[model samples]
Target: MNSPVVRLRGLTRSFEQGGVRIDVLRGVDLDINRGEIVALLGPSGSGKSTLLQAVGLLEGGFGGNIAISGTDAETLDASGRTELRRNHMGFVYQFHHLLPDFNAIENVVLPQLVAGRARATAEDRAAELLTALGLAQRLDHRPSQLSGGEQQRVAVARALANRPELVLADEPTGNLDEATSDRVFAEFLSLVRGEGSAALVATHNERLAARMDRVVRLHEGRLQHQGKADA
Candidate 1:
């Protein structure tokens, strides 16, 4: 088997409230391999998002080790971490945070542009991805002009725009209705798998979680009760 795209060991996070310590994550060890899609399931306040944040390199104040694509995040400074994320990580949230000003294609194109790709090339890639996601006709539509599902689809396209090695999503379908969520999720899974990027997606829906390659539950500040998908 290939090495993990994401590895965490002894990962822990805490916060102080009223001179009392609240432990969110306590020593979480996980490995997500290349092209694997792992589902994270937990109740609200279970620290699922905290774990994703740590692996995504979105914040500091975390204790223990986080390694992404073989590089120990602890060894990188703030700027270095930012560079690592830019080159190797993609993120999707419950909300489609698309820039209302830009059209679907442009929202997707912006990331590649920031990565220094030529404007023409970036636009081409964006169109290709959006088209594959069934958004070819909607490419010119702005976020407000599209339906909720369409907006989320555009967000999915944007997340994969950089073709990052790992995709970290915190309830990417949470805000959508069931039917829309299912459709969008199927599209998201197909696109991510087609790109061969490992993904760690957090969701509360058991049916969706079961569809993934594996499922893990967060309980008492640790990952527990891991289960594999049906063959």
Candidate 2:
């Protein structure tokens, strides 16, 4: 766990809009160790999402090195990147993005099934995660029936369903009320820690960010340390 689960060195990303060049990430360097939870704090449009996209291997045109679990992302082709992502990464967004037709447990189970886990095994994993997240009684409830916090909890369960080595969350609790956000984010932190997986959570809430193991602020396309996180 001492070594980095994910490492970024000299990362850079830019875009051209209306003939004006905009740099989102510029020579950023970071390391996220196994079992560590890191908070990424920044206001909207601060390149937090772009940094996450690079780490998630969700896009191209990023220039730099992204090494995850000892594999360099630049070394993999499209299919290989997809395989790496499927095998090692999970994601949660500002929106829950649960499958409307599926129940809470099913939403979590589907990802495991896609990852080739046996149906029984997948169901068991889903049940364990949802139950731990306090959704035991609502396993069969659809997203439409769940409250906002419950829906986000299901999303957190789904993100951890495959036992991903790294979970990337972007504004995960942004949609909820402060009370709901605190509860949901606390559960998310607990679940991620329990699984022994590293996390990079992007959030604008200083209150929420302060709870992680470490805090990094994204400013002007670079990351600045904000000191150690809460214990």
Candidate 3:
């Protein structure tokens, strides 16, 4: 009965370049329980992004297990993997990656529409999330018209559009200034918590990571639990 939102075991990944193998992940095991947020701490090029990519099923060519909501990723074919990725999780990146042509609310509503939600229903959901993130007044603004923080806020809102069980954010605020970063991160935590979604957020900022429920560091392609966030 303790089924987690995400599970990884004995996960290993390596790349071959110039007839030499470079290992990125080495037998990593992790579980993200429902409604829990875990911070992944590591230096640049330390395989943090690679680790996220593995959990994300963004690509293949790895070994070991990845189970999302009890379904094994290895057992799923390409279409199945796409279905699983779309239905169960959402991803946020350092860059907003918003559609230049779409407005704030439209960006959020598009994903929901892809998931079979009705246009009106999706729009309502989008407005709710944007309002919660303090973007009620900017609903019609394009990404270019918005500030960096506001654009990231729209990205966050879009990531959460599906009410996914797992939200994967890779240094979501890394592109912002110190003050803007703090503000956006705070809003992100609040929105995710309010939605009752578990999150694996990758960030190098100890101060920001400490705000999560737990923290884990990556070293030598392995995961080391660093205890609870408050610890």
Candidate 4:
């Protein structure tokens, strides 16, 4: 059997605010298998988003170990961590952060272009991904021109553009309406699973969280196995 694509051991984080130390994550131990989708479910201030950032390498000041694809992030220097993040990780947020000036395909291809792929090659791959996501007709549309669901779909395509091993999403459908949110969530799950990539999503929607293979809840600065039952 294959090892987990992501592993966290004794993960802890704290922040200082107004001369007070606030413990966010106590000691989290987690394992995310490749091609699996896990939902981090919690209420306000439960440390769901914070844990996502720690695993995604977006924030430091965290003690303990985070291994991605078997690479120990705790031992890596700044540059090493940056390299690993850029090449192996992806992220999506509640809002679609698409550039207003760029078309759909261009926005999707931005990461590949940033990684130094030739513009033509990147554009070609972006077009292919957009088409696969049923966005071929909107390829030249700006974010404003597309519906909310459409824009989020483009964001999903962009996340997969780099063929990343892990994608971290924080409340990805939090801002959408109920029907549209469900549709967007389904698209995200399908896209990640279709590519055999692992995803960790932090969401408040119990119905959506229940559909995932596993559900983890963050409460009182610690994690618990709420399982699909809570959802």
**lDDT by candidate, in order shown:** 0.92, 0.93, 0.94, 0.89
1-231, model 4: which lDDT tens digit per residue? 777889999899999999999999999999999998999988988899899989988878998889998899978888888888889888899998999999999998899988778999999989988888789899999999999989988888898888899999999988899999988888788888989999999998889998888998888888887567354
Q: After superposition, how far is residue 222 of candidate 3 from its true place, in Å?
A: 0.7
Q: Supply every candidate's count of residue pairs whose N, Cα or C atoms clash at under 3 angstroms.
A: 0, 0, 0, 0
The TM-score values for the models, in the order shown, are 0.97, 0.97, 0.98, 0.95
Candidate 2 is scored at a TM of 0.97
lDDT of candidate model 2 versus the reference: 0.93
Pull out the clashing pairs in model 4. Answer: none
Tens-digit per-residue lDDT, 1-231, candidate 1: 666999999999999999999999988999999999999999988998989999999999999999999999989999999999989999999999999999999999999999899999999999999999899999999999999999999998889998999999999999999999999999999999999999999988888998899998899999985776333
Could you say which candidate leads in lDDT? 3
For model 2, how does the per-residue alpha-carbon lDDT over 139-226 read when each residue is reduced to its tens digit? Answer: 9999999999999999999999999999999999999998999999989999999999999999888888888889998899998876
Question: Over all chains combined, what TM-score does candidate 4 have?
Answer: 0.95
Model 2: colliding residue pairs: none
Error of 1 at 1 (Å): 6.7
Candidate 1: where are CA atoms >4 Å away?
Answer: 229-231
